[model samples]
Target: MKITKLETVIPRDIMPGLLALRIHTDAGHIGHGETYYVPEAVASTIHDWMAKRLLGANPLEIESHWRFLYERTTNFGSRGCELRAISAIDLALWDILGQVCDQPVWQLLGGRSQDKIPVYNSSAGPSYAGKSNEPHDSHVWPGHGCVGHEGPLNDYWSVVNRPTEYVQELLDEGYRAVKMWTLDFAAHKHGGPLYLSKQDLEVGLRPMRAIRDAFGNQIEIMLDGHGFFQLPTAVRIAKAMREIDPLWLEDVIRPDCVDTIADFRRQTDVPLAVSEMMIGMEDYRLVLEKRAADYIMIDPTWVGGISQTHRICNMAQSYNVPVVMHDCTGPLTLLSGLQVGTATTNVAWQETVRSQIRMIYPKLISGTIQVEAGYAHASDEPGIGGRWLPELFEGSTYQHRVSEAGR
Candidate 1:
């Protein structure tokens, strides 16, 4: 079947900067795909540039399309908006392929290697990264508004305000692992992540200590530094985190320098999980070569898509490193990760925000991601199973763009 048209829908109201792509083919099939962050730019890349290559081409040529878009983009740049657009297109192509073959994407990618994928909750409220009315530049500080919204599903606030209670609640709900960024508040207070004073160090470590005191390693704790801290400060945070014995220190320092991360890893015994921030396989290859991270974190939508994620998983397997799926963004990202993670044997745990799953996902997608206890169940439905709701584009506030073949 030949691709006939490409369409992009931006539901900025639901999730700011979330872009969803729809690929239409002559075979009477439409496939849906999505990526998080910067919807406008991603949409432009697809409609203006990538659409010419895809239109009238075979819809099943997933690998060829990925390579073409990636190789061509690399001539200028590969990361950020260009790669994100390619990721969305690749996912749409895979979705089409899955439907054409009458199988799920995971089955197309060699079936299930594991029975169920374990999931870890990252502390975020429903509105943590959601489109906000407040006009504040979030990047200026490490974690400026770390604690947002005080409610039952506001795990971010609950984790910082009542650490032991939050831990008990998560344990009662059957979550064995949890990740949070309490240090970012202090990192912001000390003028970015360059410096961490003795007092602020104590301040940041308090909640974590509280959890350790109450739960005593019953649940694995992960500290996400958000790539904010410098190497020395990251080392100090890692040294302090040793008392709590976290599952891993994730992106404590920026992922730009694998050598520096390797240096930080050498200084601390705390297992390092370096980074969803590092995009593409080249960055990951350096991390593996340097022995920088014990565990590697990858965001399927951020890296490329299912094709790239599967490839990276195999690459990580060669290094004997476990892959952790990252999704602090949109529902499609979570579902895409689930599809690849289910088929890959070396995958450890899928990152989730229960708040987002509960509050935001239902509004955007047609199907739900099954999470019973703490494990995510794989879906056998053809294609990605869940897709962006038709009503999303029907609204007046949403932005929709289309590029049709022969137009």
Candidate 2:
């Protein structure tokens, strides 16, 4: 069918807002796509840039439209925000294709490789407003059984009531792995570089050690440094945590600095996971070619859509590196990532926030994808099998409205 209109919607939330794009066809079917960019800009890019380029185009020409948008933005910059905008449109095209053909996105990619993909609990902490230092309470935290929330007491505990308590809760919930951001609070407390002092290293490693000692390797622990360190400090921290044996050290350095990531990989024996900020297959190609990391972390929202993510996985497969989909935002991201992972052969494990599942999943059209024993199965339903709940969108600070012309 011919394309009629394009629209972008940003749903407000404490976490990064949802950058959703809706592509309406002349036949009256609307397809949805989302990007993981800052909320304010997501809507603007769709309305001001992508919508103008995509109008009157064929909805089923997914690849042509992707390249057209990419070529049109080449003078600006092929990566980053340009790719993010293209990603929203690309996902929308895929959504339209799936809906029109009466098949799921995964099925269109190539039939399902596996029924379920293993998922690790992501964003395993407290809600945005909770007290960070509130005394650890087992009853309050949801995923206490996995690994205690480890970060600044206030931010960490606020999202994950009691650190250790939530770890225990995760274990009870049958989650085999959990991930949390580590350096933000430690960096804040030190008031300088992260690895500047022995005290800083100890402070940084304490929460992880506590969890390791408590769980005794029963659970897989992953640490996200959030690209907060330089090469030297990242190496030092990775060395210190080598004994604790994290599943992977995430974004130790920025994704753009391939050389630094390669250096960090060389200095530490622990597996390095990088590229959570990557936007396309070429970005992933550079990391894989350099052997910059042992594991590649891709977020579907930032990394073009399910289509591009699948291509990146294939590229990573050539390097013999495992892929771990990185999703720290809302339910749409998690579900989209899972769809790619299901069809991927070299996937490490998917990430999810054990606590937010209840809050986010109910808004989906097909409810939520089920995760049992740390694994999730993709739905066979048409499209992504999830629809946004407009009621849930009401009064949310994360939602941004686009002009009707954009749609």
Candidate 3:
């Protein structure tokens, strides 16, 4: 069916300003997709920049549409919001394809290779949801894209006090893997340069030591560096953590510095996982070519949707490197990526904010993502598997709705 209209809705209560797009077909079928976390930039890119090209196009020609947009945007700021809009649209097209075909998206993705996706708790704290209103204004979780400060009053990490106790609680709730920021935006919080003191280093290490001591071999601990360190400092922390033996160290060095990442890999045996912020294949190519990281972390929403994620996972498989889909952002990203995980053999873990998702998901969409003992099942419904329940947005002043006649 031809795509007749493209609509965008900015939910007033949910994220206040983030954009969610719906692709409308002549057959009256609709598919939903969400772009990057930042609302204004992505909204403009989708509503004003890209919608004109999409109107009346064949919704089923996913690959052709994706390539057409990619080739044209090369000279027109190809990366940031531009790529994110393409990502949102690509995801929605796949959703429309599944609906028309009467099959779940994962089955269309080449059937399930996994029954459920292995998961790791984002450990962003007990109250990580709805903070998207102030999105980057967090007191416990590390920020995405750039470093963000956490206010002193609700420093959830400190509130937990005992790291093992914090982790054991997750284990008790049925999580086998756990990930948290060991050092992040500390420079912003401390009002100093990006150097960590002896005391500062120990403070970060305390949680690692606690988990290692408590579980030994039962739980896997992953550390998030949030691109917080220089190469030397990153190497030092990697060296120190080698004593505790983490599953992998993530985004330890600024992901842009390919040479520094290579250097860190050479200096220590600590397994490396790079940023989900990487949008270009060459950025990932450099890491894989140099054997810089043991794992590739991809956020389909940031990198261009299911199509790009499938290509990246295939590339990683050729290198014998594993792929993990990141979740600490939007539900569409999480749900779509998890569906990919069900079909992608090279995938290892899917990140989840347990407290955030279990409560918020039912309110926003029709499908249920059930998690049991550290693993999550993919949605079985046809299409992209999510049917948006619109009534939830009934009366919110902050909401903005735009249709293809043009917002």
Steric clashes per prediction: 0, 38, 0
Q: Per-residue CA lDDT of candidate 1, range 1-407, in tens?
A: 79998988887777876898889999988888888888899999999999999999998989999999999999999999999998899889889998999998999999989888999999888776676554445654312445765775888888889989898988998899999988877766646578889888887789889999888878999999888889889888988898999999999898998999999999999999988988889999999999999999998888999899999999999999999999988887888888998899999999999988888899998888777788997678898888778888675567889899999
lDDT leaderboard ranking: 1, 3, 2
- Candidate that scores best on lDDT: 1
lDDT of 2 at 101: 92
Candidate 1 lDDT: 0.87
lDDT of 2: 0.69
Relative to the true structure, candidate 3 reaches a TM of 0.90
> Which window of 10 residues has the lowest lDDT sum in candidate 3?
146-155
Each model's lDDT comes to 0.87, 0.69, 0.76
lDDT tens readout by residue for model 3, 1-407: 68888766665455433467788988988878877566777877777767777887889999998998888889866788888888889889989988888988889989999999899887663234344333453444424322223432222453136567667777887988888775664534553125666676786778778888878878888888877677877877887888778889998877888878988999999999986967888789988998889999998877888888888988998999999998766678888888888888989999887655765556567767667899988788777777667774355453554646433
lDDT of 3: 0.76
Measure candidate 1: CA RMSD. Answer: 1.5
TM-score of 2: 0.86
Candidate 1 residue spans exceeding 4 A from truth: 134-145
Off by over 4 Å in 3: 126-129, 132-160, 189-194, 392-398, 405-407
381: Cα error in model 2, Å:
0.9
